[model samples]
Target: MAYFSVRNITKRYAAHTALSNVSIDVPEQSIFGLLGPNGAGKTSLIRIINQITGPDEGEVYFGNEKLAPHHVDRIGYLPEERGLYKKMKVGEQALYLAQLKGVSKADAMKKLKYWFEKFEIQAWWNKKVEELSKGMQQKVQFIVTIIHEPSLLIFDEPFSGFDPINVNLLKDEILNLRKNGATIIFSTHNMASVEELCDNIALINNSHKILEGSVKEIKKRFKTNTYSIDFDGFTGPVNPLLPGGFVLTEDKSDDDLRQVTVTLPATATQNELLNAFMPYVNIHAFREIIPTMNEIFIKTVHAAGNHSINS
Candidate 1:
């Protein structure tokens, strides 16, 4: 069974519909990417999961049981909008937040110390939050969020303010949390991060889920059967060898190597294309050009927009 499941959830604020019959399952100990453009109801679904607000219709399940008020303590949420008391001492604020998440003061302090040391921010513990740089403040908030070791973690743009080094540091920690059996729902606009970290993804568009699948499966499904080939010498009229169903998209030569990109018809297999090209050129390398997450996102959103307009 899925560790967390949002089942046919719908939310409305007066006349505005924020989410429309959205449903997704987060498997245990996996990194699930919650993706969408701004104002596409991603935050609405997240808020509902956090129990900051109730859904107008449908249900959420944690394991086999339905979600309840008491379940709030089991989740750790780091919102895109940072919220830390500027005037409060870093350690003091972290402890207070950790306690709110149900960790005892003593345990919170112990965990906080470990995290501070690991992040090399022990010197900043006594400093007021406002004294730290934006990235440092973000690190403090992140430490507070995970101190209690919640089962389900929701990170909405968690890497927003950090430099690349700190971003990698936090990513490593997130991966560690998953390794220790935590389920994560990561919401971000960074498609590269999604490709690197997410096991599964659900893409929302205009308050609805337009795409949902494992990252690999989704990419494969959206592939246009494109391939890239590199060859040497023997450059006879390359266009003649190209099958009727294949479209040559790009052709270039650098020194002795010739590179070409071909988009095949749906029915064409890689083997067939390879066989046809082998006789014309000394085949050096051949590879299918799978679509990137960014490409898929743009294509899907554009298609959805066109569908909406036509309908």
Candidate 2:
């Protein structure tokens, strides 16, 4: 069952419709990706879910209970924009935020110290927020967001200011959070991260949900039935030997080994392709070419007839 689900939620601002009948289901203890181009209503829906704003229509439910103000305590949100008091010391600021989230002073300090040590930022504890770099401040903000240990986490571009090493570190922590029973709604423009961290995703464009499903299933659904094979012992052109309805899209040879990619007919099976090539070439490796999330995102958005989305 879905731990959190939005049903036909709509939001408007004056004459503009920020979201139109948008809905999504986030499974418990899983990372659910919320994806869309700018001005696509992703932020609007997030605000509604956080109770920062009310939807013009529809409902949001957490488990079987309809979303209410009391639900705010169970959620942690890290917005795309950073909001920190420049004059406050890092350690003090974190403690204050944690207390606001209902954590006891002693517990908050203990948790803060643990996270500071983990991120190797213990040395910066006494320094004011204004003295830190953008990435350092981002790290502190991230710590505050999760310090309360809320049941559901909403992270919008959480990796924005981090270097590659820190990005991977955050990814590991996010996966670990799920293992520890925390549900997450991740929103970002990084398609590569989506492929790595998201189990499922819902793509919103033009204020509408255009696609939603498991990452593996979506990639398989959009597959083009293309396969690449690397082999040896094939000296001559295999086009004449290949059965009808197979197109050799690419062929590369280096001395003894040759690699070729073939597009099979829609009705053809992997076994059929294997049987046809086995007689002529020694198959070393055979694998299907799956489209990446980046490729799929562009294709789906364009197909939805939004021409100015790239702008």
TM-score list, all predictions: 0.95, 0.94
lDDT of 1 by residue, 28-61 (tens): 9999999988888999999999999999999999
Query: Model 1 off-target regions past 4 Å?
Result: 309-311
- Give Cα-based local distance difference scores for all models: 0.91, 0.92
Compute the lDDT for candidate 1: 0.91
Model 2, 86-106: lDDT tens digits are: 999998899999999999999
Positional deviation of residue 311's Cα in model 2 after best superposition, in angstroms: 17
Error of 1 at 166 (Å): 1.2
